[model samples]
Target: MSKVPRVGIGVIIKMGRKVLLLKRKGAHGEGTWAFFGGHLKFNESLEEGAKREVEEETGVLIKNIRAATFTNDIFPKEKKHYITLFVIADFAGGTLPIKEPQYVEKLEWFMWGKFPKPLFTPVANLIKKGFNPFKV
Candidate 1:
């Protein structure tokens, strides 16, 4: 476990009344649903990190990206701490294919009120705070 909190970016791709979600596979939040994102690479801007993660994980391009909110996700069991930055983005293009199958089990679109069970910790924390990405 690192001494400092790692930075992560989460992109909430909204289309109509639904948002994209992915079932995690081999990472820290395995078996839980999360947005299309991952760790911010060295020297990458937040927007760049979000775009890269979305494309790398879901083979999708996103646009109109803006900072949404954030959550302090600490998993003692996993010995991981991440300051997750949430960004709201619109689906610009690309097919919804699971590019990184090793990290993601599947992808799906869901309404905010009808999210799948077992959400990733950061997302759950956001929800607990009543942070609605749809609300402007």
Candidate 2:
């Protein structure tokens, strides 16, 4: 294992007044709601990673990308740590599909303050920091 903490890119894709969130499974935050994202690759800028991840995983194209916030997420039981850069992007256009069925159970958009319960660690952490994507 790379002993160093892994860097993750979490994209908060928004449309209208709702934010896109996916139900995670077979991972640390299993069954929890979170944004679409993945590990950041070498030599990639934050915006680059944010755009690539969303397009690759959820088949969603985003534009007007902005740096929203970040979270230091550590899973003690799994012995894993990731410093996730959470970025906000408006939903440009796409036909949503459950591309990675193994990891994603489903996807849905929710209002700002009415997000579903049991969010993935990083997202929950963001709320604690008071970062609002809609207002950004």
Candidate 3:
């Protein structure tokens, strides 16, 4: 494992009381539910990274993007660590997320208190921290 940890950005796109979740297949959090996001590219602003990731992964757009919360995640089994920055935004409009057959099993909307089981560890950590994306 590298001595340095990576930085990941997760975009929490909230619509009404729902949030978007992608079922991961062949990634670190395989077989778990996670937000649509990836690592922050070099020299990219947080907001830029968030917008870029969402578009790249889902081909969807968002508006009123804003910083939300973060989590410090460590996965000993995978021998990885990440400083997870989360941002909340509203779905702007465009093509909805693709199923991403290669890695994503499904793209689904879930109510705030009705997240699917076996959440990605990072996302589960957020809930453990008492995170409520709907908070002002």
Candidate 4:
């Protein structure tokens, strides 16, 4: 049987003109910049999962969470598929720290239209579709 697609939530915490991004350093999407996020926990709502992921990964609290867009991410080489929900939110509080060094290399703020390359597949796909969280 083929593996099923997992559900994920990507949080874009906006601070004025910039959004938070992290360089991934794990099995999937290594060397690519991505928004803070992770797999959704069972029975967790999308908003809850987004908040949890952002806080867990970057130690940043977010609020005013809203659904921005989504993408169907399929990594055939990795044998992984995911339906990722993209959320736009405001940075509420908390210090930004590299909480999970195992999965992330570094965190930085990038202007919306000036993102660094190479971006994670899902984020790149979203950008290609003209999905702008800031405009939502």
The best candidate in terms of TM-score: 1
Question: Which pairs clash in the backbone of model 1?
Answer: none
Per-candidate TM-score against the hidden true structure: 0.96, 0.93, 0.94, 0.95
Model 3, 25-134: lDDT tens digits are: 88888999999888999999989998988887777789998998899889998999999999998988777757366778888889986998999988999999999988
Runs in model 3 deviating more than 4 A are none
Q: Which stretches in model 2 have alpha-carbon errors above 4 Å? A: 1-3
Residue-pair clash count for candidate 1: 0
RMSD, one per candidate, in order: 0.9, 1.4, 1.3, 1.2
Q: Write the per-residue lDDT of candidate 2 for residues 80-107, one digit (tens) a residue.
A: 8899998889999987898788889899
**lDDT tens digits, residue span 90-126, model 4:** 9888897888899999989999869999999999988
**Residue 127 displacement (Å), model 4:** 0.3
Q: What digit string (tens of lDDT, one per residue) describes model 1 on residues 1-136?
A: 7899999898999988899999999988999999988899999999999988987887788899999999999999999999999999998888988888999999999999699989999989989989887897
How well does model 4 score by local distance difference test?
Answer: 0.88
- The positional error of residue 48 in candidate 1, measured at the CA in angstroms, is 0.3
Indicate the worst ten consecutive residues by lDDT in candidate 2.
51-60
Candidates ranked, most accurate by TM-score first: 1, 4, 3, 2
Clashing pairs in 4: none
Please report, in order, the local distance difference test score of every candidate based on alpha carbons.
Answer: 0.90, 0.88, 0.88, 0.88
Please estimate how well model 1 matches the true structure, expressed as its whole-model Cα lDDT. Answer: 0.90
Q: Which residue pairs collide, candidate 2?
A: none
